[model samples]
Target chain A: MFVIYCPYCEEHREEEEFHASGQAHLARPLDPDNCTDKEWGDFLYFRKNPRGLHQELWQHTAGCRKFFNITRDTVSYKILETYKVGESPKVNLEDASHG
Target chain B: MDTVNVSNQYATNSVTERAEFGDSNTPVIASALEHANMKSLAVKTATGLGVTLVELPVTGMLVLRARDDKPALAAALKSSLQLDLPNVLASNVVVDNGKSYCARWIAPDEWLLSCPLQDAFEIEQNIRTAAGASSIAIVNVSGGFTTIMLSGNNANDVLKKSVTYDVHPSHFTVGKVVNTVFSKAQVTMRCLDTNHYEFIVRRSFADYVWLWLQVASAEYGISIEIE
Candidate 1:
């Protein structure tokens, strides 16, 4: 089985140790009180479920009780990296294309 | 080496006196960070009572603390422990070398590195240099704690006595590690395999925990391993 790194416990555990939280890097609006209904709706519900190399958030509910990110290929189920919640992951398509 | 034998007569007492190590006046032997018999600390259980229990001896454990500012220290940890330090929660990294394994990044500023009891100091030294100039802390806690590998039939029943977390297989399967309060003590619990788990607790609390475990497993019978 694949191992995902937990930002809270700070270790890479088996995938079984984690629960997938759809979509990573989702942010709240700067001013929720001023935002439109559509902005709030998009912020709350929209996500990218691409065929390859998708980034998502996950939780280790049983282990350290923290959240982190996982970059995986949905089609192949191959995970590229698991990083901390606040930090950005290393796998960017833009960077990969340049290299 | 001294085991306080609780007669069947005193089994009714909630707080029974266990044959103690260290000072006699102390309520319980705080094996927390103390070496018990050169092997890890453990509690022995009587058989034929349907009591299910497991004991782990001086398994080595280390605690590493660092911050995001300490890039060098983090790198050193990566090279030394060979596991990535996730800045978030519920994750762990494992690297093995024959007899021992190192599990790193169990917390934001802390990491737990476990090995054979004797290798504790050496492992500490290797990581110490990597932590220079960083506001980091690495403490040798092998003395304060010992481990119990609990699994097999009725393992969950034993855990239920101490932990408030849900240990149901559907929630806590293999490879998950949790730090939770166990009765009056706090422990770092890791699910090893489907039927096995590893509980690391302070040594001073071993006797108390051991006693509580007996009460918890009054039905399944316990097996003791004396090395």
Candidate 2:
């Protein structure tokens, strides 16, 4: 049984306490009102699902009630980083060694 | 023409200021939960500041919402209480010095500040002066919340069980403040000192958090600090 660290609670709790939110650091367009329908649709729905390393956002809805970024390998299930709600994720997959 | 002593049967239970009503009494009251293994762990600052670990009985908490754009409100708060309002994930300290204080912040045009059982009036006046007519509201949450102070060698361990925020030394250093969840309930956590932390929670959920503390501290053998 593995546990995930909750950035808000400061503890590594059972994975059940957290829900994985994919991809952090999304910025809303400055002028969403003037965007085309396709642009808005792509912004809202597109995601990068890589097989190796992935940068994702996770919300501790059952725990901290805050959002954090997690850099982990999908195959190995190894978490690289967990950052705060407003901060940026500091993971670079190219520099990291994946198992 | 001033000779009327009206009998107030209704006034007995209707104390307008909840803090003053409970002021004469003590603030920290022990709980009466029956369990075969009623274990507790209380910790305090290494420096031995009155920073203690306690599970407060029935208390009230309110989440104050206000617009930081209002200059009058900010000025009023500083002048009356000497409290610097916190913005976003930040928090401020309110005290004559470091001895006593009530840290507050701006949570998206709103602020959450807590004080002793009876300091609501002064807090109200100060807020009114600072937040002059700029779409601000103050709701008395005296009957809604409670407080718990966690201190000691393993208080952080207990907190780690319920909160998802990083409480590591690098992330949650002394004087850090966070509004997070404790178990299933939401709580505002403030690090008062190196080994001490304070949590503000709803009255209805106090029991749940307490039970959580008990279970979380099973390995640490929590020491209850009774007043």
Q: Pick by lDDT: which candidate is best?
A: 1
Report lDDT (Cα) of residue B81, candidate 2. 68
The list of candidate 1 runs beyond 4 A from truth reads A1-99, B1-52, B86-97, B104-106
Q: What digit string (tens of lDDT, one per residue) describes model 2 on residues B44-136?
A: 212332223566543323356555454655666677668776654566775564434464542445566666544554566556655655555
Candidate 2 Cα misplacement greater than 4 A, ranges: A1-99, B1-13, B16-53, B57-62, B68-70, B97-99
User: Compared with the true structure, what per-residue lDDT tens digits does model 1 show for residues A3-94?
Assistant: 66665555455555567889888889999999999999999988887877788889875566578888888878888888877787889955
DockQ, prediction 2: 0.10
Scored by Cα lDDT, where does model 1 land? Answer: 0.64
What is each candidate's DockQ, to 2 decimals?
A: 0.18, 0.10
B93-188 per-residue lDDT for model 1 (tens digits): 464766555564465566687777656666666666665555666676666787766655777777866676667787776667677557766677
User: Each prediction's TM-score against the native?
Assistant: 0.53, 0.57
